[model samples]
Target: MFNVELTSERIARERLETRRKREAERQERIFKEKVRTIGVDVKALDMQVEEKKARKGAYVLLKADAEDRRYNFEACVHQNRQKKKSREMEKALVNYRHQHQMPSTRREFDLNDPDCYRKLDPGDAQMMLPGLAGEEQDSKSRLKRQKEQLREWLLCQQKELRQGKLRKKRVIKGMMAHSSMPWTWCLVCVPARTGESPPRACNRSFSSRSTRSRRRR
Candidate 1:
């Protein structure tokens, strides 16, 4: 009688173990389906994000380039004005020298002799044109500031490029994860999807042939 009871208990335990395995396998299948769906969704989301970022960066770069060009043009204009002003100053000094019989260069003029300063008419002497001088200095300062801003924008562009590349990589990796190619997706999703895995093509540890063999088995 005891032997029969023991046999019945062993059979019951075996049945329970089989039921547990079936339940676990069912859960695994559901999980794999969810993973595949999520992988495709993630890939789509990444692509959209990358495109948006690229568009934003392109506009920013265009504005930065325009500003850089504007600064360069202003600098050139100021440089030309500076040359014209120096020439005018030289001609004025020459005329003053001829009228007063004073030396041409400042080094030749005697600062101790009040006669040298008297040669240039105090009331009529035009000091530097305030408007022109101010404009020239303002242009130079603006050019310097714009150049610095351009450098910063260039660095930002570089960073955007890197981010764009990284996002592309993420999209590719997601594609590989969902691929149906043998050994490609299987290896990638294996540790993540053990039993009842999806038909993803992974390139994990195994070779193509071996991964296919495991899939068949």
Candidate 2:
């Protein structure tokens, strides 16, 4: 009876050992599966972050390009304004000198008149001078600059209008070319497909003769 009890106890211990090993194996498999899932999640999150950064970078570049274009346009407008103002000032100087130095054709005035600079107000002459400071002077300069800009803008507008005419001519020429025989001539374009025999070439002379006859009429 002791031997039988010992055998039964040994068998029970073996079954418990097997159950423990199976449970351990199941826990290991679950841990490995969790690790794999976490790794995939991390990779996906990294990809999403990289894509967001790329999009942000692209947005920044596009904004910078637009700002640069606007800056260039503004600079062009400013330079054009200064050039116009300088021209107007030069013209005014010339007219004032001509009136003072040369005798008028309609009325006889002394060519060597000493009152040439006297006719203009002290403030006006000072404003025309290189450097001066006052609120009124600042206002005048701003007005003058604006007037100069207006003239510059007008000249630019005129130039653009003239160029538009040239552009129209070019478009008309292009239209004529498109409507004419060379553009109208149909090309027998046959793409050679893979694993297929190419189509036979058509007679070029016969096709050209037909086109020529149509054009002549």
Write the residue-wise lDDT of candidate 1 on 132-157 in tens digits.
Answer: 54456567889999999999999999
What is every candidate's alpha-carbon RMSD to the true fold? 53.9, 35.1
Tell me the spans in candidate 1 whose CA falls farther than 4 Å from its real position. 1-40, 102-217
lDDT measured at residue 169 in model 2 versus the true structure, 0 to 100: 62
By summed lDDT, the worst window of 10 consecutive residues in model 1 runs over: 186-195
lDDT of 2 at 51: 100
Q: Report the C-alpha lDDT of model 2 over 1-217, residue by residue, as the tens digit.
A: 3545688899999999999999988778777865434335777889999999999999999999999999999999999999999999999999988987665543545555568578768777854545554436477889999999999999999998997677556554544465544333223322222234324554442344566689899
Q: How does each model score on TM-score?
A: 0.29, 0.29
Give the per-residue Cα lDDT of candidate 1 at 85: 100
